[model samples]
Target chain A: MEQNLQTNEEIEMQLWEYIDGSCPINDMQRISILIERNTLWKQKYDELSALHTSFSTNVELEQPSMRFTANVMDAVAATHVAPATKKYINKSIIRGIAAVFFVMLTAIFGYALFSVHPTTGTTSMLPKLDTSKFNLSHVINSETIMIIVAINIVIGLVFLDSILRRKKEQQAVKP
Target chain B: MELDDTAVIQMVLQGQQAAYATLVTRYQQYVFTLVMRYVNNREQAEELAQDVFVKAYRYLADFKGNSKFSTWLYTIVNSTCLSHLRKRKDETILLEEEKMVSISDSNQAERPSDKMEQRTQKQMLENALKHLPESEAQALTLFYQGEQSVEEIGVIMGMTTSNVKVKLFRARQKMKDILQSRFSRELNL
Candidate 1:
C-alpha cells in the first residue's frame, strides 16, 4: 500500500517495514519510487537503511566469559542432562487436584439444587419449590457484584501501573 | 565438520556429552547478549545466560526439533529472563524510556556539539537500543542478528506477529529519533 504518512513516526514505521523487506512486492516498488523521487522519503529511507545496516554489520554480540561454556558444562555434569520433568511432577498429585476440584464442583451444584424448599401445596404432579426462600439478593445483589468488580478494576489498574513504571533505585538488589 | 544443532543434539542425546559444548559455544554470545537486554550487569547476565544453557540441556530431551534450534533456544532465554525478573519483581530492571527524565529533560543538549558526532554509528545504535524497551530491542536484535522471522519472534516474546512488527516500527522510530536529536550534525537529517 502507498502510505501517505503524515507524522515522522508513521513515516519511519513504513520505512522500517520496507527496510526489513516485509512489505508486499507492490508496496516495496512504490516505496522504492517514493524514496527516489521524494526528498523527505529519501532522507528517511537513507537514515533507516543506515540503522538496518548497523544492526547487521556494525553491532557486535556481547561475549560471555571464557569459562561460560565450561561452567555450564560443569553444572550439567553435576546434574543429569535432560532432567525429565516427569521425575518431579507427580501424576497422582495432578489427579488428586482434579479430584478435589471435581468434588468442590459437585458440592456447589448439590447445594444449589438441594437448597430448594418444597411448597406447602403441589402446583402440578411435581411438588412446587419455594425458590424465593433461597434469596440470592443478600449474597449477589447488584451492589455487592459492583463492589467486587470495582475492587477488581482497581487491582488491575494498580498492576498495570506497576508494570509501566520502574523504580530504578531498588534494581540492584539481586533476586 | 561442524554439526548442525539438531545433529549435535542427537549426538548428545546418544551419550555424546562433549558434543553439547558445541551448541553452547555457538550460542553463548547470543544468549548472553539477549540476557544483557534484561539485566545490564555483565556478572548477573552471564550467570543468567549460563543458567539458561544448563536449563536447555536439562530439557534437551523435550526439544523435538519441530522448530528451529535458535527459536527454541530463544524461547528458553525469554522464559528464563522473565522468570528471573519476576522473582525480583520488587527490584526489577527499569525501562529506560519510562524514566522520569526524557532526552530533552536530560543534559544531552548541553554536551559539546561534537560529542555525539564523534561517536561511531555502532556506538550510537547501541546507545539507542539501550534506551528502547526490552521487548522492542529484542525484536530488533532477533530480526537482524538472530535470523528470526516475525512469527518466530512473536512466539519467543509471547506477542503476536503484528505486535512484533509494531515493536520493530517503534524501535526504528525511537532509534532514529535518538540519533537525529543526538547527532544531528553527523547525520544529514
Candidate 2:
C-alpha cells in the first residue's frame, strides 16, 4: 500500500508535467501507456484534463474603465517628456563646446591684460569716449523702464502659474 | 503589418507620445486582471493599473528589452500590487468582502434552477481559489490565464522556474482538495 501511494504521487507529478507540456517525449509515452493499462491513472488523467479545460474556458480577463487609456495618456502628458533620442545631448558635445568657449574667453582676457602694459602705466589700447556723449536720459524714458519691468513680472507670473498647474494636475492623477 | 511591442516602444521613445496609447490599450485588461487577483477591489485595482502604465511610461528609457515586454510589465504589476498590499494589510476585511460577493453569487445561482448545478460548481471553484494562499492563487492564475511559461512566471513572480512549477503543482492539488470537500458537503446538504 505504501509503495502504491508513492507510485500514485509520482504519477500525479508526471501527469501535471504532461498537462503543462513539459514532460519529455519518452516519459510522455510511458505515461500514455500507463493510462491505457491502469484504471487509476486514467481516472486521474481525466479529472485533471477536465480541470484544465474549465480553467482555460471559464477564467475571464478583468477589464478596467473605458477611459483607462485616455487617463494614462493624460497622466503621461502632464509628466515630463523624455527626450526623443536616447542620447539627447552627448557629454562629448557639451565638453567640446565648453572647451572652445573657455579657450576664446581666456584669449580675450589675456589680450586685454597684456594690451595695458603696467610698465607704461597707460590704457592706450582701450577705446576712449567722452563721458558727456552717453546719456541715460537720451537713450531711455521712465515709461520704457516701467514697461520692461512690467513685462518681466508678467513673464515670471506666467512661468509660476504653469509650474503650479503641473503640480496640481499630478496630484489629481494620483490614487 | 501591425507594429509589435518593440516597434511601439521605439516610437514612444522617439517622442511620438501617442504611440504609448497603443500599448496601454493592448495591456490594460491584462494588467487590470493581474492586479485584481491581489487587490480584489475593482476601483482600487483600476487605479493601481493606471499607475502601472504611468510608471512604465516614465521608465520606458530604462527598459533594455532583454526580456519580452509582457514579462517586464508583469514584473512591474507584481511589485506595485505587493507594495499596495503591504500598505493596506487588510486581508480580513478583503476576505470578508469576497465572501459576501461569493454568497451573493450563489444566491443568484440558486434562482436559476436549470443551471443551478453548473453555476454552483463554478462558484465552488472560484471560492476554492479564494481559499488558496495569495502566492499560490497568483501562480495558478498566471499559469492558466496569462498563458505564461514557468520561466516567464518566474520572472514575474521572482521565483525560480522549478519553484514556479512546484507552486503550480501544489496549487492544483490544494484546489482539488477544496473542491472535493465542498462537493461532499453539498451532497450532505
**DockQ for the candidates, in order:** 0.29, 0.18
Model 1 residue A149 CA deviation (Å) reads: 21
- Please report the TM-score between candidate 1 and the true structure: 0.74
Candidate 1 segments whose C-alpha is farther than 4 A from its true place: A1-7, A83-128, A132-175, B95-97, B100-102, B107-114, B187-189
The residue-by-residue lDDT of candidate 2 on A1-175, one tens digit each, is: 9999888778888999988788899988998998899999999998888777766776677879899999999999987545434467688988999999999999987887788868865566677557697788955899889999999999999999867755653343232
Candidates' chain A TM-scores? 0.53, 0.43
Question: How close is chain A of candidate 1 to the true chain A, as a TM-score?
Answer: 0.53
Model 2 chain A weakest 10-residue run by lDDT: A166-175
Model 1, residue B98: what's the lDDT?
52
After superposition, the stretches of candidate 2 with alpha carbons farther than 4 Å from their true spots are A1-6, A81-175, B90-124, B183-189
- Candidate 1, residues B1-189, lDDT tens digits: the string is 778888999898888888889999999999998998888789999999989998888889887665788888999999998999889877866755554256555436445275676787777677767777777788888887788887778768877567878888777677767767776566454
Write down the TM-score of every candidate.
0.74, 0.65
Instruction: Compose the digit string of candidate 1's lDDT tens values, residues A1-175.
Output: 3455456667777788788788899989998999999999898888778767767886778889989989989888876665456767899999999999999999977765666556633333334667888888779989999999999999999987655432321131111
